[model samples]
Structures are given as C-alpha cells and as structure tokens.
Target: MAVFSVIKLSELEGAKRIDAEYYDPEYLEVKQKLLKKKFVYFKNLVKEIIHPKEIKREYEEEKQDYLFLLAQNVRPLMFDLSEKKFISEEKAKLMPKNLLEKGDILFVRSGNVGDLTVYTGEPKKIIASSDLLIAKPTFKFSYYLGVFLTTNYGQKILIRGIYSGLQPHIAPSYIKTIPIPILPEEIIRRTEILYLKAQNLLKQSESLYSQAESLLLEELGLKDFKPRYKKTYTAKLSDTFSAYRIDAEYFQPVYEEILSTVSKKHRIEFLKKIFDFRRGIFISTDYYTEEKTSRPYIRIKELTGKTGIDESKIIYIKDNYPIDEANSLQENDIVIAIIGDTIGKTNRIYKELSGGFCSNNTGRLRIKKELNKEIIPEYAEILFQSVIIQSQIEKKKTQTGQPKISDKEIKSILIPILPLSTQQQIASLVQKSHETRKKAKELLEIAKKAIEIAIEKNEKEALDYISKSEEK
Candidate 1:
C-alpha cells in the first residue's frame, strides 16, 4: 500500500515551505487534531524565544565562580549539573541574558535537534551555551508545555521543521510557528503535579549521591585536601626507563598527591585483587541490522550515568546474530569506557540493562567471587568515579590518535579499601540514589504518556490513564 497526501495550493503558499517533510501527512493529522481542540501558536504562549549570545570565554576549573551549561548538560526533561564547566563572574557579566531562571524551557537548536529540558529552579545563577534556545513561558504551568514538546507527536513536528544540509538545524522562527494545544485545566494540573514530584525525587537522588561522596572524602581525610602544583619535580632516569617512555603529564604532581593521600588514609589494593576486567565483544559493521529484538547493543554514547540506559538510542542486531554469552552484561557489573574521550567514565549495570551486549570500546569490571565479601560493586563504582581512582586512570591512559587504557593498566589501578561497615553505608546511599532516579523517570514517563493520550484520544481518557498509572 502506498500512502498519499493531498495538499491545497493555498496551504503551500501559506507555509512557504516546499520540503515534503514540512507537510508530512502524519504531522498534518496531528495539527488537525490539535486545531480541533483549543490551540494557539507557540509564540503566543511564550513571552519570548531566543538564543544566547556567543561569549568569548575560557574555562576556570579551579576558581569556578559561575557555572555554564552546554548542550551535553541538557538531557530529556532533566538538567545534568554534573561535570559542568565554569567561568569567572567577571566573564559571565558580559552576557547577562544567558542566565537561566526557574520554569524556563530549553531546546537544542543545532547538532542534536529537538532535545528539550526545563530548568527546575536549581542553582540560582547559571548560564547556557549559545546552542540552546531559551523559551520563557508566560503560562503558570510550563511543565505541561515541556512534557508535550518531549512526546512522540511533538518531537515529529519539531523534527519535521528542521532544515538539513551541512548540519541539522531548527530556528526560533520555526519553533514559534509550531501549534500548542490548550489542554484541559485539570489535565495540566495533573501533569504539573507529576512533573514537580519528579523534580523533587531527582533532587533527592542528587542529595543522596552527594552524601555518599562526602562519606568517601571524609573517610579518606580528603574533605578539605587540595593538590598543590610545583614548578619543578625530580624523577630518576631509571624510574622513567622502568615506567617506559615518559610524558610530562604522566608525572603530574596532582596524580602523586591523589595517590599519596589515598595510601595515607587506607590500605590500597590493586583492582585485580577485587575485580577481574573483561573486554566487551566486537561485532563487525557488516553484521549490523535494524531488526528489533530484546537484545540492545550499547555503545559509549548510550553509557550516560545521568540518563541511565536509553533504550530508545540502542541499535539492535538481527535475531540470528551471534552473541557471546560471556560478554553479555549482568546485574551489578560496572561498565567503563576504556577508549577515547570517555575514558574512565563508568555506568553500573542495573536490573533493566542486564543481558544487553556491551560495545567493544568498553570494558566490564566483574567482582571476583572470592573477594566479593571484601568489596561491594556499588562502592567500587563510586570509587571509580571519585578523584582518587580517576586520576590514576588518567595517568595510565596511552594517547596515540585516540586515548586508550589497556586492560593491564586497568587491572593495575589502585583502589582504596574502606571498612566493610563503611562500604555498606556508602553502598546503601548510592543504591537509594539509583532507585530514586528510577522513580523520577517513571513519573516523567507518565506525564509524557498522559499528554500523548490527551492529544490522540480525549481529555477524559488521558485523565483516566494518569489515574490508573499513578495507582500502579
């Protein structure tokens, strides 16, 4: 069967867009349904939609007076404040309008178009990169608007408006023309409630992780410790020969400081003593397929800790594709990026991601059964993310064209050993953080589904779905 769409001459003239995607039948149907109910241009609902002015600035890592958010900081329906770059207050003053406030909606305009997130009133003063389009909604319930934009129907319309050539792009003018349905007040209220609840849960998750980090630092007596850099350092010729060819970065004072601090506070043990490193499977590109299956092939990009594992982004292989059972992920396994810019980044496998195929560029750290009683996987994961182990991993990384750490180097990385009781306390906090984040995601999905149901069916049906989902 062939699908056809008939468009009127006047409609084409009105849109001034000759691209077939701009007039896709599915988008037209969604538009018609929205128009059947109360609808208004997106520009009318928002006070203004604008992009930030480009700032000529440099990152001030040590003196981080002002925080800056890049496109990577904006995840779906959430803002990832971790690993943020900062600038001095003097530099931030140059562009005051870029400062974000509560209830403001952010949309990605370039590279990863159509990605959206709302600033949920955290970090009183922060600025966003120029790649983000900031929409300041005049309506009280902006969360409802944010939820709608992230849904399948909303994403399709936004994506269809994209102009692809050198790069995929969406302009503010195109975003202004998108239609927004004026949903029932009750439905909007329910969405706002759920959205706020999710935000609260996410905050709890952040706080729990912070508590766990604090415990680790306090235990190691590094709560107020700072690395001091010296202009000159001495290293013996024999030492350099034994460690192989030397780079100035490999002998940084900060690396030694981190190592010395950990050794002083706790008994240090090599990673091989507690966990065995296993490399992920490598499948040739010729074997790749679009066939949908229960198995997901996870790449480095999909290993984001903040978003967990995005099932939507995973590429599937054919059902008959050979899978190495030994390389398959298991619950509580720690997946680390052993190659490229993502080196040292880690994501602990949860129940939902078990049985997925890991990418070749990654490595898994499975707890040694004999030493499992001494080390907790959750605690080890947090340690890997901490400054102590990360600095060591950074020093050991070999940079050719792309940076990579060998499995031998990974096994040789030292880990600080804390008391089992202390490990349990930290593990419990981290586990709760993951659970809270899961709850936050569940609530956010309910809100998105409710908006979709309301648009495709009726307001009453959407409300019923929300009620039933909440019961579950």
Candidate 2:
C-alpha cells in the first residue's frame, strides 16, 4: 500500500519546500489534527534563535567548574550525562550568547536534527555548543515545546522539515513554520510542573550513581588517585609479547598504575571467571515490525548506562521471529556494546527488558550461578562503568578499522573483586538510581500523552486523562 498527499501549487509556498518528503501523509494528517484546535506558531513563542560560536579551552586553569554542554549532551527531553567535560569559569564568561537559561530550549540543528532538550538552570552557569540551536521562550513555557517535540505526532512535523544533505539538518527558519498546539493555562502549568518533576528525579538518579562510584573508589584506596599520561614512555619487549600486542596505546604506563593501585586492597579476577558471555544473534531487518507490542530488538544504542534503556530508540521485531536462545535477555543480565564509538558501554537488564532479543553488535553477560554470592549485579554495572574496568577495556579494544572489543577480548579484561559486603552497598545505590530514572520517564510520558490528546481530542478530555493518570 502507498500513501500519497496532493497539494495545490500555492500551498507549497507556505511550507517553502518542494520535496516529495515534505508532503508526506503523516505530516499532512498531523497538520489537520493540530489545526482542529487553536495553535501558536513555534516562531511566535521564542524571542530569538541563536547558534553559539565555538569556544575552546584556551587556558588551563586551576578550576574548570563550568559545564560545556555539547550536542551529545542535548537529547529529546533529557541528556546523556554518563561522561562530561568542563571549561573554566573564565571561558564561560566570554560566551554570553551561548549561556543556557531555565526557559531556554536547545535544538540539535545538525546530525540527529529535531532532537531537543530544555535547560532547567541546574549549576547556574553553563554554555551550549555550536551544534545546538538555542531558542529562548518568550513566555518561559519551554516544557510546552519540549513535550510536543517528543510526542509521536510532533516528531513527524519536525521530520518533514528536515533538509537532505551529506549531513541532514534543520534550520531555525523551518522551525518557525512548525505548529505547536495551544493549551489552556491550567494544562500549561501542569505540564511545566511534570517536566520539572521528571528533571528532579533524573538529578536524584545521577546523585545516587555518583555515590556508588565514589564508594568503589574509596574501597580501592583510589579516592584521590588520578592517572596522568606520559607522552614519553618505555615498555619491555617481553611484556608486549606476553600481551600479544605491539601498539603503544596497549603499553600505556597508566594501565599498570591503575592495576597496581587495585591489587593493594582486593584480589583481581578476569571477567570470564565471574560471568559467562554470549554474543547476540543477527536478526535481519526483514523480520522487523513497526508494532510497539512486538518483541523489542535491543541495539547497542539501548545500552544507556544510568538512565537504563532508552525506550524511545528501541525497535521491534516480529512476534514469532526465530532467534537463538543464547541471545535472550534475562532480568539482571548485563548487555554491553562491543562495537562502535561506545565500545565499552554496558546496561544492566531489569524485568521490563527481559525476554527481548539483542542485536549482533552487542554481547550479553550473565553471572555464573555459583558466583552469584561473590558479586551483585548492580555492583558489576557500577564497577564496569568506573575507571577501574574502563581502563582495561580501553587497552584491550582493537584500534584498526571500526573500533571494537571482541567477546574474547572482553572476557580477558581484569576487574577488582571488592568484598561482598562492599559490593552490596554500591549495588544498592545503582538499583535505586535506575528506579528513580524509570519514574521520571513515566511522568514525562503522561505529559506528552496529555498534550497529544489535547490536539487530537479536547482540553477537557486531556485534563481528565491527566487527573486519572496521576492517581494511578
């Protein structure tokens, strides 16, 4: 079946687009439903759009406290805070146009265009990178735009405006033409509260995970240890031959330094000794399905560390697709990205992710039944994310072609064996963080759904839905 839209010649002028993709049926259908209610043009709500100038860390200062928000940090309704970078307070002061405010909405103008996130004014002073298109909300209703852009229908409008190129992107000019459904004052306030509540939950999640990482470092007697790389270094020939590598990166002195620090307090064990690993099976795209109810096909991108699985990015496969039993995910099983730029990243599976099939690009690790008493699943997740294990992974990953760490290479990586009691404590914090993050996502869904209903149905119905959903 084919879907088509017929438009008059004059109608094309309003969209300022001549491509067939711009006239997609999904875009037309969403526009019709949005026009059913009073709406505001996206351009009308914003004071102005800004693209920040590239800022560099010109001076190395004693303090680099201010966060330098990059395109990677800005996601739809959230950010990836697993890793971070900072600029000095002096550097931040030099870029006033790039400074983020509570009411500002940051849009990814290039790469994954249309993805956006709102600033809640955390840390007070922060700067946006050049890739993001910063929109300052005139009415301070940033959440309103954030919620709309995240919804199923809202995405279609943004997708329609995307320009095709070597790198696909959207301009601030195109954003001005997108329609944002006008909501009642009561509902607007409700949406704002819900978004802020979600952000707060995310903050709590980060704090808990940070505590877990700190506990591990404290136990390792590395509470104050920071590895500094030496540009001029030497390695023994026998050491390289034993490790089966000739690369200078594998011979970095920092790797031995970190390992020596860990060996001081706890015995170290190869990852293979504690957990059995299985690479996920390949499932062809022919078996893929758009139905959300189908079995979710977990890809490498879903291995979001602290935030748990990114549910929005998850794709689905046929209900009865044939897959290997070893590829099956179980609660507490660990899924790791063995390929690409995120080569060493991992995510601990929860009950919600159980029974799904993982992609070939990932590997599944389940603790040995006999070793269950030796290590907790939560602690294992925290340990891998910490520098103790990440350094090992960094050394083991293949540098040629597309970078990757094979399952055999992963199994070869060594990890510290913290005491069972200490492991349990760190595990507890990681578990709590995941649970908090889940609740925040739920609240965001309610807000997005309510807005969608307001456009498709009526304000009264949407209000009732919100009231009922909150009670549950």
Return the clash pairs for model 1, or none: none
Off by over 4 Å in 2: 56-63
Tell me how many clashing residue pairs each candidate has: 0, 0
Candidate 1 has a TM-score of 0.90
- State the weakest 10-residue window (summed lDDT) of model 1: 304-313
Clashes of 1: 0
Q: What is the lDDT of residue 266 in candidate 1?
A: 90
How far residue 234's Cα lies from its native spot in candidate 2, in Å, is: 2.0
Provide TM-scores for the models. 0.90, 0.94
In the order shown, the candidates' Cα RMSDs to the true structure are 3.0, 2.1
lDDT of 1 by residue, 1-472 (tens): 5677788888994766887777889888877776787888889888999799887557655647778878767777877665778887877888888888888999987877877988877876788879788999998888888888888878877887899878888999988888888889999999989999998998899889889989988897777888776678877788789888487777777888878877887999888988878988887766666665666677887777644555545777666777778888888888888998978888788777787777899998899889889988779878888888888888999989999998888998988899999999999999999899889989999999998898888999999999999999
